[model samples]
Target: MNATCEPRSPRAVRISSSPAELAGLGTLLKCVQAGVGDVPALLALAKDVGDTAPRPGAGRTALLWEILASVTAVDVAAGRILEPHLDAAAILAQAGGAAAADFASDRVSDRVPDSVPFEGAWGVFAAEAPGLTLEAGDAAGRTVLNGSKPWCSIAAQLDHAVLTARLAGGGRAAFAVNLHAAGVSFADPKWTSLGLREVPSGTVHFEAVPAIPLGGAGWYYQRPGFAWGGIGVAACWLGGAVAVARSYQGALQKAADGGREPDQLALAHLGEIDRTLAALIQYFARTAARIDAGELSGPGAWSEALRVRGGAAAAVERIQTLVSQNLGPGPLAFDPRYAKRMADLSLYIRQHHGMRDDAQLGALTFKGGHPW
Candidate 1:
């Protein structure tokens, strides 16, 4: 209500994704500088007081902020906000245990250490992908890690990170690593121009590095909270999608009211885009509510998480394409918000893993009770 859709997102949610109207916290947008397309301004938003840390059940609102922030900050800021939520979820899953969760629980709660950047490095790029090789051997009573982890975001700037590695015997174990520890070094940044350049993600090399072992081998991925965290990433994607599509909102509205001139050919595309956005927004709202209610569990949870993620990724691709086609070169060339958002969302959703991931959902579906 404060302004018409800003050719960005969040400012005009009332006109798009109803029932999820973005209100207040408009300050999060200033975190980006369109002309520069960098994240220093966005990163500055994290300098809030200790009380600014997210509390329990703040995931949905946090996700909305992630979306809103992406409209301007180009997802670097949103991603910074998102990783901590995931860290909290992981720790919250292992609350009673004193294993690796203890380290995470100690740092992720109400009084989390302020301004410490954390990244989650779980993706592997090697086709052979033996995974981050780790031996169970002891080094003077300290756990020794040797190998590399791909997608370690901003390891240079990050003080700590959560990682998953393959043990000598082949089972996967999770660890909280100190980037400043001895023998920990980062490969030159491999991520170039896929849109999230500000994130600085690449492979991190560890030679006899020290790490704090967290939960058991399977706890990192098997826990219910893992699925919830997956949904949070989808929320970020949807946020970026909304921001990208706002470029065509006026066209969409005029088309809906009978296009007068100039863009009559875009009418059908605009209408379809509107419907597509409505459905995606509804699904996003439902999933976020389920997460907040702790209703996503049982064997069906991962199935449902995949449903949200896959659907959001597809919707984002569709919206980005339609918006670009309908609006032509004006926005993508002159409007930094639209250009950056399109690039960011398009790249970020690549986390979906394509058919390889869909195959996991297929396996779940064949087992029945698939919560679609």
Candidate 2:
């Protein structure tokens, strides 16, 4: 995929604490909180000639951009090339929420060297199977693959996919599979889930489909970037938790009517949930800053990312309890908003990478001798 790498604007440059920076991050968070529908429209307008890139301006949108820009700046500070590919994928994922499949479809042709490996894991997990093996043979004048990848995330819509296959050397290699090629098919075409329903998390079957190699065998877990991406996934979980917490606040205001006695038990539960979320957010922010400062490296960075993931997962569970207790039993049946919030929260919480055995191991490695 073609991308232009221009010098980053002043705003893109990493800076120490500043009011302008804080304001920017707040705007980005607010934008994420407001909703995802406005993003395409914003991007479209921002693309016009002679028009400056859209700023968050006065509203929550500005705050959301600031937060995102701050994060991006951190990446820049860490000596990472701030590629549009990474930023675009992150933006699309956030903007589309569970329904990001539509956006993924349009960007299918823009596959990069890294997309295959990243989405390959998603496919394998969706399959919920023991493993996936990628194979290559001559087909349609090119190398082709034969295997199945379930829960390909944007696989149903994307033009190409990065697939993993077992090598003769007893390791795995990621191959890029073209979705539109002959012998490539999607199974269970009409499936949908509660959150990220638009992601088209279905099964993909490759019958000797053409494929391209992504690096060498055993590159998946060997690369530090993969671990870094795991941290980003945790950030997304934190975002979902933020959404749930905000939704709970709105629900609480609506529940308070005519000076009704606030349920003491429910309030206590909500308070605890708030504290948990706050702690997780702080940890995430701190980890991100450390990553920016170059203090976290090697396994230490991965361990910290896992810690954030576990913290986020626990926070989500607590938030769910708060939502259920505060909203009461009747809200689920009567309030579609509450139902949607719960559904979204539940689906987002299932991101399994954070809770994997490796993450647990990382936690143990980091928290040696620490008392709970």
Candidate 3:
């Protein structure tokens, strides 16, 4: 029963099909791969998917995550841009009430009035900063977002955003704001990172920028869809890990084809990567099913989301370590796709709150009816 003595997948074992294929997103995957490095094309693809992809908590939640995973596997940056956009759409769909009303005013004639069936690229900007703050206030008659929001990714390029802002009366609420409307501007900070270089997250400033409230005070985090959206981000992380693992798989295949047999350590790393990824994949499937079945519609979903996000972050780090320790710097220096994925994933996974999230999950366990 020695762990080190366990058999591993044969060197000839081909890279398995991803969930996207099984979920019938094969054609979409092909289109994404074809549009790989083009930001505009990728944004268009994201919009198309947001318009067409199934909403979370729907019966096809698994397929939705599969689509997200498939997009990330092809290109991490694209997936980075795509995820929040899709999540924004899904949030609006979940908020179906006065929040779903036509937010587009006289200034913006092109945007989708309904917003649930999104017509343009969207991003979520909810991250808080020390001094920077966005506030929802009434300017004479209409609701307007004033102040600034940090970590607004692709803010200049996105057509709209689902962002959180402090209310004048003292509470946080989610709003659908048109990025192109008057008084909306991006700080356009200097982004020096190589990973996700195309997707720069800068400060977005709103000066009486019109916004339509999506949900009631505290509803953004209070809703179950919030947890679902967080898990969807984890799906992207899982896909990025899959893309990195493929690099390792390709190296093994190349070595074998060139008559250089993989050593035991290499095989062991391969086994570890496969097993870890398999567990994460199954976790996603089960979580998706529960969401679709309405089993995780309450506070329980917070723990579930934290578990997947934490587990995925750890799995990604482990896979990255295994690949880097074994393959050395050749791929890092020479392989653009592989190198970009590594750097992008390293940044993307940081969205997980790390040990703070772990602590939250631990505290949740003390509460009765925890996910044990």
Q: Which candidate comes out best when scored by lDDT? A: 3
Task: For residue 323, give model 2's deviation from the true position in Å.
Answer: 1.7
The whole-model lDDT of each prediction reads 0.57, 0.47, 0.81
Total backbone clashes of model 3? 0
lDDT agreement of model 1 with the native:
0.57
Q: Alpha carbon lDDT of residue 287, candidate 3? A: 89
Candidate order by TM-score, decreasing, is: 3, 1, 2
| Candidate number achieving the greatest TM-score relative to the actual structure | 3
Please, what is the TM-score per model?
0.76, 0.64, 0.90
* Candidate 3 residue runs with Cα over 4 Å from true position: 1-23, 104-118
State the lDDT of candidate 2 residue by residue for 240-312, as single tens digits.
5554555565555545643544477757766887788667656665655565555554556556556666776
Locate the minimum summed-lDDT window of 10 residues in model 3.
1-10
Clashing pairs in 1: 100-214
Give the candidate order by descending lDDT: 3, 1, 2
The collision pairs in model 3 are none
TM-score of 1: 0.76
